[model samples]
Target: MVTALRGVSERAEAWLDVERERIGLWLPVALGAGIAAWFALPAMIQWIGLLFLLAAGALVGVLAGWQRRLGRIAAVGSAVMAAGLLLIWARASWVAAPVLAQPAVTAFSAEVEAVEPQPAREQVRLIVRPLRRPDLPPRVRLTLRGDGDGIAPGAFVGLRARLMPPPTASLPGGYDFAQRAWFDRIGAVGTVLGDVVRSPGARRGSQPLRARLSAHIHAQVAGSPGGIAAALVTGDRGAISPEDDEAMRRAGLAHLLSISGLHVTAVIGFAMLVAMRLFALSRRLALAGYVLPIAAAAGALAGAGYTWLAGAEVPTLRSLIAALLVLVAFLMGREALTLRLVAAGALIVLLWRPESLAGPSFQLSFAAVTAIVALHESPMMRRFLARRDEALPLRWGRALAGLLITGLVVELALAPIALFHFHKAGLYGALANVVAIPLTTFVIMPMEAAGLLFDSVGLGTPFWWVADHALRLLIALAHAVADTPGAVATMPSFPRWGFALTVGGGLWILIWRTRWRWAGAVPLAIGIAALLAQPRPDLLITGDGRNIAAAVPGGGYALLRNRAGDFVRDTMSEAAGIDAPLGALADLDHVECNADFCRWRQGAEEGVTRAGQGIARGEQDAAARVILASRGRDRIEGAEMAAACAAADVVISDRWLPRECAGRWLTIDRDSLAQSGGLAIYFGERPRVVAALRAGDEHPWRQPDQLSGNDEAVPTDALAP
Candidate 1:
């Protein structure tokens, strides 16, 4: 055993000796891990062991300085990890804002922070700051049911609005908007009740500029083409029809609409190229060694300006930072693109907004960039993918091949994240990107830029006309690709554990430069297996307790009611991994549903039960039935709830059931739904629930959690309830 252990140690040291160069690349990864750790905590505490860890890390770092190789690496990693935790803790504290406790209707004058004008509907969304109540939160989002005329960012307006705490997930395994709202410092979200009373104020901000530019683009190009152009240029996507947006998503070209790395790179690269060329025209400037830095500065300035115009959203800001880093590296006479640069970008983003670590934007963007950089860093891939001087046809073929390969690589890298967030992954993104990337890079963007430039001179019509036609081709391409068979792979939910394993394994593969990196395939394969084997929920309930969906024996879901809006249906569909509409419960086989309730007979015979966690196989047969009460609280009585609860294996209710009413296995009602946020019911010999929000969840923005834990509840209790 000793001999074997020594041999292993020697081998590890050898591997470390060779792979040590890659250590620096993982600093940002360490930081991100810390940020993720902060978010994973159920509740905040006094530094959450930050001080001890920091001190311990410092001690290790100091000792490691006295040692060599592996010790030094551990020291650096530990130190940075601790620093990352500190940075996030500080960020969270700095951005922490009061959360709205209950619903309220009050008239108040407030300064508008942002405005999103939707042409499709009369309603407009605005983020505002209430001027008066010391008890009120600083920021609230209001959706006014009107044309929202004469209201712009920086305008002060007095109006009566119904304000409530931001919503949690609409259903289990769905996005949590409240967490995002917390970071954005938006405490309340509601609708305006009365007409707006606009007050005069200087309207100057990115929204005004973005609104005007977006409107101008919309005027120049009509319909979907104009919508796409406007979104690309100004990041105002209200103009894009839902049909076209969905097509873009399905085609895997939706990134075009978001001002991300590609757009940022294009703007900066073009600016740099132009600046360099202009500087080269002056021989004195070129000879004075000022060309590269000056061009880089110009590129950075242009990128910053574009980012500002794009609303400085997380993704745009991240891309701009990464681009600036590249420019900085280039001017310093170092390799511009590297994993270290990706790390720096990630570190900056995390430090700026620690909560962004939980968001798809940060994860997806950073993951994509990291994978791309690692690919380029590999000597084998570099040799294989390197562009060479050759015949024009050969060069074009190689370039196309490279684009396809990069797209495939990025697609694979992002698949887990996509699945975790959206319950689906685009399968044909690589094939679509092969055409879309160049189309956006060479044709559409140039024409659009020219159109914008010429619009100022009042001669942009022809350019916009050309852009419109080119966009038509792009949209057509997106539709054709989206309609292709097996365009996307779907699953109901990729569990957090599986997602962690996959991302961890992927990072291992990407970060390590040694052949041992192949070991990551083991965890990656295991995570994929877990994702595939994950059991589907037999039933799902919306947060509001108004809608319920049960799994059909064969496939898809049976809805208790069809009157639910598209949003609810869509949310359920995504969570159920069914791309089509959910059918009515009454239409399903062996199911009886009425105005009051729906009963479905399903169990072992129909493979409704899994082996573990719930009722085991063969424990029950098709004779078993699950019932859900369809009536609202005011309409349903306690006796009826008890009877339904007793008659079924699982009981779900739209009304609040008395404490005495408990089903055979599980009973869920409006009261429980309020506590759980939403629920995923798994029917088996022993039915179980997966809740979006857990009991005692004390996150500040999780409604009554923070309020109930303090005296804050008194006012909220008296005011709204």
Candidate 2:
């Protein structure tokens, strides 16, 4: 026992030494822990704990920075964790402050904080802060219904508008729009009641510099190729068409629209190289001081300027920070692309917005960089690089092989995350990237950058035209790739625990500098197994309880209504990993649909139903296993329909069921749907039901009662009374 204890102690000491040597890794780990802690907290108590953590973190930071070797690891880790907790909590609390009985419709004088024009919708997104209400959320996003041409960023305007808080997730295991809105400081969404006439009382706020820059670029290239040019240069995607965006996403080229590591690196690298060369040409200044410092400074400034011009969104900001870290490392005469530099950039981002840790943007960005660093340091890559000075043919072969390997590694690193979040992987992403990346990097981005700079002086037309043509080719390539057979492979949604395990395993594999890192494969494999075993919900109902889709036994969705809305159909298809066409009902084995009802059955099962003409008062309807209510037909006034629903095992309706009919059957109605957001029902002897917005969502952000003011109650599908 003594020998074993000594051995364990020695191993632990050695591990601790390794960690100390790689001290920077602790920051990212702590940041992750802080985010985890924040999410683990109950909604009600989250803010309170965050406040306490803030004060504690500040104290720890002060103490830690005071001495170099006074329990340095423990102090640094504690400080980082505290700082992470504080940042997220403070931001959340400030953005999501409680407001009771905010008017849904009101006339208020407002200053347009920012204007994001959507050419596709012939509308404009106005970020407005109310002039009068101190109690209102700090900002509201208002979509002006029509062409509000004269309106620009910083223009104050007054108009009557309907405002409501951002919506919660429409379904269980769906994106949390409310959480996203909270971080964006968007208290509510509104629509203009009428024309957005500029109010004389409107005061100009700080101008949206990025929006102005993008608008200027768009004006120069207004008709033909301005959208992609503006997007590439200014990170403004407002002009890109929905079709193009979808094509890019499906082809795994959507990252081109966003300002990311590639863009930042290119912009800063070009600036640095130019600045260094210019400085070197002047021998006096070059000899006076280190050219590296001057060049690095120039690059950092360029990155910062570009980030500011790109709205400094999370992804852009992350890219800028990463660029700065690499530049600063170069200035310090250290290798720029080290793990320490990666950790520093990640730590800065987490400190700024710890919530980013959960977002796909952060995960993919950091994972790709980390994987690249690991690959660079791997024995295989080192061996290849050792022969870089060989013959020209061999060198070219090495370059091609390196590119292929890098692309593969990045795809592999991001695949699990993409699958978990989107439930679809781009089957031809690497091929698409290989074809598109060079054109984007070498041709399109450079021209766009030149266009943006020259457009102000009327010299950018040729550059803009060149960029546009390149973009056209890129788009054509993307569409071609996306349309290829098996271009995207949809998979079932992975469970949260499984995703968490995958993340943990991946981090272990990347961060642990030991042979034991292979142990991460064990958990990774388990996570994959867990995902495979997870089952899709049998039936899903929309938030308004107006639409539903039931899963077929073999794995596909059948519309409960023949003409399901886009939201219902898309959500169901995505959840079930079935890329069915819109309003597709053919997937079900034995399906029948009419204006009155839609029904389907599989083998021995008593299948699902909708309250329709063919379904009403039928003997099959009366004994139906599950009955879905008709859309826009909430009132069940007739005795026959009520009687049939009452006899059914589960009744889902959008309208009000007769009072007498409600007691016998399990009914999900308008009131419940309104409160819960959406419903998921599983079919079996004992059906399981889940609500999108549960009792816990009674928190300030999800006041269900407040959300549905004066809305009429209707019935929805219910498994139990």
Each candidate's TM vs. the true structure?
0.91, 0.85
Candidate 1 error regions (>4 Å): 1-6, 43-66, 200-207, 387-389, 603-623, 632-634, 703-721
Model 2 lowest lDDT segment of ten: 712-721
**Model 2, residue 318: C-alpha shift (Å):** 1.4
Worst 10 residues of 1 by lDDT: 708-717
Tens digits of per-residue lDDT, candidate 2, 47-69, equal: 46664765565566567443433
Model 2 regions more than 4 Å off: 1-6, 15-20, 40-83, 98-103, 133-138, 201-208, 220-225, 453-457, 561-568, 584-625, 638-642, 656-659, 662-666, 684-687, 697-700, 703-721
RMSD of 2: 7.7
Model-by-model lDDT, in order? 0.78, 0.70
lDDT tens string, model 1, 118-176? 66555689999876555677888999876677577877677777777888898777999
Clashing pairs in 1: 615-685, 615-686
- Kindly report the root-mean-square deviation of model 1 from the true structure over all alpha carbons: 4.8
